[model samples]
Target chain A: MLDFSLNKIFVEGNTDQKMIATILEIHYNISFPYNGLALEDCIINCNGWQGLFKQVALKEIYRIESSGKNLIIFDADNTSNLGGYTKRKKEIEVGFAELIKATKKNINYSIYLLPNDSDNGDLESFYMSCIKPDKRFFIECWNNLYGCLQSKNEARYELKIPKSAGMVYSYVDLFENYRTGFYQNKKTKRDYSDDGLWEYNFEENNHLKSLCKFLEDNLNLKSN
Target chain B: MPDQSEFITHFEVSNFKKFDHLVVNDIGQFNLITGDNNVGKTSLLEALSLNLKSNNDLVFKFHSLLCDQHIHHHAENKYSKNPIIPKFNYFNLLKNKEELPLTLVFNSQKVILTDIDYFRLKEEDKDLFVSTPYFMDGIEYKYWIRIDKSNVKPEIQFMYEDDYYREDRKFESKLYKPIVKFRNFYERDLNKFIKELSQIELLNLTAFDYEEIVSIIKIVIIPDIIAINIQKINNDSDEMIFIATKSSKGLFVNVTRFGDGVQKIIRYLIEVYYAKKNGFNYFLIDEIDTGIHFSRLKIFWKEFLMLATKLNIQIFATTHSQECIEAYAQALEELGMEEKGRLIEMEEHNGKVYASTLSYENIKAGLISNTNLRGA
Candidate 1:
């Protein structure tokens, strides 16, 4: 069972959960199954933005009586019709305010919009930015093919999938020959952090550094 | 149905069993209390029952019931055959031995229960207690039950102030007259069930009430039950409840032969019908889902809430089943009377018990989001 008594990080999807868990483990040497049953216990996947907002509105985030930290991570999804970083943050703040009013517990929590909190994109945007400079050609080639398909109006027919997920899948497949889609099947799902294909050079990427700082300030080691 | 305006809207308990101080506000017509084990859910029901303004005999009866003491009836005294003297340790009711009095407040009416040592009183004072009514000024009309150290049995007495007339004197001072019906989980008294059945027959209920009761029983208990009858056997020595189902043909089968779930639901519905006919406005049930099957919980809650609304009775029931809580929320939504139900989550923190009242909106949100509202 998930140990809700400890600190928690509520993410939008399973990929986000994997990504955050990987970032914490790689950067800070933090490990999973932190006082819980498995690696994904501390970081909960709310399934989607709707599920996350529903949890907030239901005051579920304040269910436990712990002074541990809580981090909420969701994609800005700026490319879609959904709102960007500022708007998503504000929506969460409003829902969180209502929850606080209902529960009245002193919760230590913070919100981080995906792709460096201020970007108008998601975890895919962050991962694309963190790719090794030498390995950038793989994503660039995929993007060029994607643009050609869009010019011929064959993008929907040929790709018919999320562009970022396709780019990540193709990039990882080029080196590992995994041939599997990103987050397609649970049994053969890829671990974004454990995979050595992606180069998360935090020293070179300021956006990644900012996220690490935010995590370092919020995710305490005492809970683990 | 009784007037709905007179129900208790709020209650507070101080120094009661398992609660140093607990306050539950915004009480609705239907309340489902939930918590972890030993969190005092049943004690809250007992506190509510004891807070009711009842006569001395009824008060002692409630005390005995709370203490789990069996009252013995003697054939020698006809009028007072069943003398309910509290036979348990009185200190068990207190939160601590030093906490002098346990106070229960229902709305504005307050009941203070204090235990006094019988051996501490002066000899003259003891002689006065055995004689005529002991009158004193500014006594505050408390139920002073003194327990003898040697026997550990309480001597029940009621003291009044000087201005109170002898004819106007009674136990508990008649602050609130709402009749309370309590049902426990373990004890299924067949004699009490038969008594309630006779009372329901004497109530002369209308056809609609009888039909509603029968339909509720059919929906929640046995779907094949066609008719119910009470028969006396062994030369009127005992009464038995018999039911005729579709499978039973024209003959009636004794209810004792069926499973406990059927008998429990029947006894509960009959008692509730009788209490409603007699103008009862409050019902407290401990472990309300004990004998019933899990699959029948939704229908049971639906029918139970409908009956409570029709009878205008405020219900306070404790539950350990998550399905029961979910069923209650669903039933409230199905009836479109979401405002009438509340879930009181009792929790213990730092040696004090607290209750968090969740409205229908909160409960629905939690249920939809799959949140743990049972405080487990």
Candidate 2:
């Protein structure tokens, strides 16, 4: 009911939003304008923070007390350098330190980069092996990574992405902009024609409104 | 000691009812004669008035209530350099115990009577001595002393303090009319004599003027309720007034609203004011530590006594509070009033009223040796 001109953030990515919010929420108990919040101000997710720890994002986070909600997130898709040759914890800490330095300017705009670049050296290869570069392909990759990361003891940065992105990401990623596919294990089909989920991808996930409210209310909560 | 400059050095009680053979000497600056409830603290005060000018009927009714017959009240005042001629007087009450021509002599002294004690008095005159002699009952006693000696007059003729304060102030006060001495009646004009007898003014005399101090005390002391308003009134076409406060609803509200500590502080301050304005002369307080919290009791003696000595009011009070005793002792030691003061306690000894002097060490021992404090 009140003016929300400076209240919240609206994220563009699913994994980036949930990972950054869920991680910080669990670790520090510090709430934020999660993925979906009712506000006029702009927002970022996990991918934003680890974006080379860019000076822009850092500046943005710090100005949040005045400017508004500042959220940051990063990609954990590539490097396995997270795990040390002998001492794995050291490698994770050093890697996180580097990422933390990049966004030191804003101080308030905290960053989140997951499944460290050091984790699971080759996730793209594994996800791509099962599914081709089609509509449901990244979805399949999201599901695989999500499930694998669920089992891994890696730092937040090292955790794998969801296989098929838990179907939740289909609403955000543009389906019409790319080709998509789904593996038919029963039919033993390699690439079923017209069986892609390109229509479901990049669609608005309306059911998530309540979920975002839950996140928003749970964190950065306004008390009566 | 130059007779200590007291106007009337001694009193003569004749047919003063129950006071048959009362001869107490050394009328010093502070005389504290205390005993059990009926052991005659009031009787002694009444006998002292025989030397001064006071109402005879009021004095007679006092003896009628005591129901004692024929007591002699004889006294010698320090008006002249002659101890040989004692100023004695006889107030003869008829055999009926009520009717009498209570005649008071100015400078008359029956040297024969002073030389001969009541043990030698004939039974008929002894009958004349007790009854119609001195007032004995508590209420029938009115303080209207007519001073015969000008320069040697009794500044404060006589006073009687009943144990009326503790026993339901509203109900028990009806036991008798409390002593409110009229200045003109007692040969003391209120405005003129006040300059001599007045003690140090606590803060300011006017309650309105003292609002600042009272308010500060209210703040730091945190009283449950505080009121400081002064009103001037006409008494018998003369100005008179009293200062009081609704202070609080009661102790219960104070404890919940502000704290027990604050209530305690306010109480101590009022008591200190009482002691300061009264002078180091005569104080008859029944219970010294009522509503006084234990934690703040220490301040009562340590700081309060310092103020008390300068005001010079000889404090005579009773206390069921062991802390009171302890505080008085500590106060005496700190203020060095121990050597200058006396503590007389009334206790029953073998069914007879007995009194004994208590020193600072005794007070300390009484406090420290109590079984309760040992465990605490």
Candidate 3:
């Protein structure tokens, strides 16, 4: 097993990681070793509704040398104050620039953040357009499951979930399931014979091609 | 041949575009303007181009496309409360030994000059002497001339306009014709300019059209490289594959397959060649480093200096690369232009754009550990 270097690619999830791995395998014929220091790695941390932003920040700067290239992809918050996000990026950059040398070679990290003022939606919309709209059935189901979690309802874990909901997650479960069972065809949907509900666990879809495709398209992995 | 005295001597615009004021103190044989992006550097060049076109009727074809320039006015009328109202004012370019005052206050929304807009000298009001010669040409080298025969000079003066076509209805008729009315002024050899313009070539690939220069390049086969066949379709705009590699390992990618640095270098080559061939005498390129690579900056500047000196094609370009300054210094030394070639640096101070010369000596000073060359 070639240990893939943890490059900190800033992609969506494990599904994206596997799809990228498959692409490298079939196209470049190189197998990626996950978390092995010799092989490059990219650990993607999210800046979504749940502010898990701190997770992607500090330690990942070192992973840049492990990967062939490191790219940080971020989406702007189109909420109200555009400058506020810029300030946030500036804060983080200033916070990070202090650590790295002011040269190109140190990290070779290029940050790409899409502007929020677009009349159209963000990268999610772009991903949705590439696949069927109802394909995010797993995300819908995950959010549905979180919406019902009693701990999520009483305005409890305000520090964890979105400002509105509070939910503590340990398994990185949302991303794992999002990668595996994002799409549902009639047959996959009809597999709800046990409880009239099809709950997809990440390890369960190890052989499904649709799961891989969903990850590749969403994370902008090299499809060739 | 027109007398040197009769030619447009000089011009300096104040409150024009990003330039609030510029003296242009002494016009040199060659001028090269280099600075960061959007620093009012191009704005100055555009002002000069506009001034030049206003003065000369040399080889400008914009006169033939008047209808196209005004079409935007009709489109703009959709949102504006006013119905395509035109505006005009004189910069009073010509000034006698005394100080010449120029203001950009809105004179009128009228389209044509209609004789009511001249400075109106009656041999009593006391002051009227302004000759600001400029050439304002849009991309593709389109230039136009602005003239007013009814002025106190009684004789008309044509100043060249740049980047944009003048929408003034009064000067529209004068856009055509040579410098000296029915007979052209300088008797510039058309064949000479055309011969120069034609020698230039480019990758010439347009997103919408695949039939340009890209269609004519002769393909060669090389060993060990994909047979050198390229597939450039509109469908694969986002997909960039390495088409060509180093000559040692010749690959087959389309011209667009290269990095922006190589692409811009190719583009600048075409422009330089075109300018050198035709006695364009002057070039104004904005955003000189939009897609240019720092590594290739030396080659680009060297090639430009060589061609500029050989063809006597004076150029003015805006750049955001400090490397460009270094290259300019080296280029000056290479072209033996240490004494000539004006290098002007522009800066935006408190919302206003101003310029100062980045002298050859100053460039030398900065090369040795100084970061504050702006002061120099």
Candidate 4:
């Protein structure tokens, strides 16, 4: 039913959708369609990366390109076995190159790998980069504690940067309940919510500039 | 009368072939069954066909299947006897007992095959039995048959408690015959079923508009086939042949000779067309993706979904191909029918077949994650 009349930004999952939606809203004051604000504008989270590679999604991308631009963002998922970041990113690009060319005559579309800086990381890495500077001290304390936990059990802290950053920005409730020391917290555990991080200083966040430009160009193209 | 519009929502097959007790539930309008080879996928389709109990066609079809397997075994071993026995191998019943009936239940309606009878001639009756001449000398065929031998018919009892039909109705009266006569509930239309199998010409069925027939077939078949029509060769009334014209060359070709893939496509199109036209409750197909190219499978499924949706007919198809299974998942999303499809994977655990019904969401997830739902 979504004929993609509105510029469609396809993401991997809800986390990416919500994060990008929040960014679009806070930075550019552009409310997403699913938020009961922008009925004619939104992000299309296809649930997982495979959905983007599916023929159904490919067909949808073509239809969306007819009247609007379609932006596809995927987690590089560049683990070590997949030949690391550069090769993995090239693989994805080459895989979709033919399909992209097939639809280019009728529609404009762009592919943006997550992290926006390198081809090797995921949305978690991007989220890590965009963490509010005000929470730096709490994050440092959390990292020190995570290091001690890792020294006790290395496997527990695998992929340290993303996981550590996740704890800082996502699990803010745990930090808020901390008593006096870093490891001392009340008997309370809560889910991660990305609501506050949307209002971070996007104007100075160089990591988000290309993505912002894509969204701005899409919006301008839609209005014209 | 069971609601003529109401289709089989679920089925439970017991003591049928390898399935001791296989129950498949949450059957949607479109279903793609996938599993390992010996997991009873074809048996599942046979069970559904038995539930329909359309006519004596199935009895003959089953006999042919058994005979083919038997003949192939002897043919493989040159030292085996030349006189091949033309006896119907007793149907496989649960616990290997002859009296145990193979039961097929479609919703609440049941078709039970009971009273096992095999045609065996007595010593005296054997003298009266004559060997029919084999016109082809290369193949030797021998069988025991008495001219006065009683037709060994399997006693099929259709038992249902639905009050919608007349209580005093005779099962014999509703028995499906080998002629094209439209009937509603409690009847199997064998001719209608055969018409679909032989690839019925769309022109013969006057119920459909000529333009509508061409358009639907165009979508159903390969892109090269631009149009379909029936040609009555030499003004002969019974000599109508299905024909298709290539888009680029305008060269017409007989539909049957157009390779298995095209024939399959045409067969499916005709089945859907007639099912809709005649208000058939269900369309049963085994290995729906057979002979279809992997790339064309998506096209086949997309067209199938469109036609089935238009007709409002429920389909039960079995497949072993992962491409076939994934095609359904892809079609559901493409057509925005994310909730209208279901994938049931059959498995054999401890010598008993069990069906694990997967919803569209589950199938999508399984496919994306590359999980082997098709079984080991």
Weakest lDDT window of 10 consecutive positions for candidate 4 chain B: B178-187
Order candidates by lDDT, high to low: 1, 4, 3, 2
lDDT of 2 by residue, A1-224 (tens): 22122333323243334433442344335344423331112233212212322222222221332443333323343324443223433433454466346434223332222222233312122223223234445555666666667678468677545433334334223343333544345232222122242121112332222233343443454322
Tell me the lDDT of model 3 at B304: 62
lDDT of 2 at A85: 22
What level of docking quality does candidate 1 show?
Answer: incorrect
For model 3, how does the per-residue alpha-carbon lDDT over B268-334 read when each residue is reduced to its tens digit? 4444444433334555666565555565555556656665565565566665566766776777777
> What's the lDDT for candidate 2?
0.34
Candidate 1 residue pairs that clash? none
lDDT of 2 by residue, B1-376 (tens): 1121123333334444344443332132223333445554444444343332223333433433332323433223322222111122232223223433332222233221222122222223212222232333333333212222332532211211221112221221112211112112121232222222232232235564245436645444444335532222433332222224355443222122334344334333443454344221333343445555665555555554544454454334444555655655565676666664444443332333323343344334334323111100
My TM-score estimates for the predictions, one after another, are: 0.71, 0.29, 0.35, 0.48
- Please state the interface RMSD for every predicted structure, separated by commas: 5.2, 39.1, 19.8, 13.2
Tell me the tens digit of each residue's lDDT in model 4 across A36-103: 42322255556656565442333332243344566777676667435335665576567567656644
lDDT of 2 at B262: 42
Per-candidate alpha-carbon RMSD to the true structure: 7.4, 31.2, 22.5, 21.0
The positional error of residue A188 in candidate 3, measured at the CA in angstroms, is: 71
Best by lDDT: 1
lDDT value, residue B185 of candidate 1: 21
| Candidate 2, residue A51: how far the Cα is off, in Å | 89
Question: What part of the reference interface contacts, as a 0 to 1 fraction, does candidate 1 reproduce?
Answer: 0.03
Clash totals for all models, in order?
0, 74, 59, 2
Task: For model 2, state the Cα shift of residue B372 in Å.
Answer: 13
Pick the TM-score winner: 1
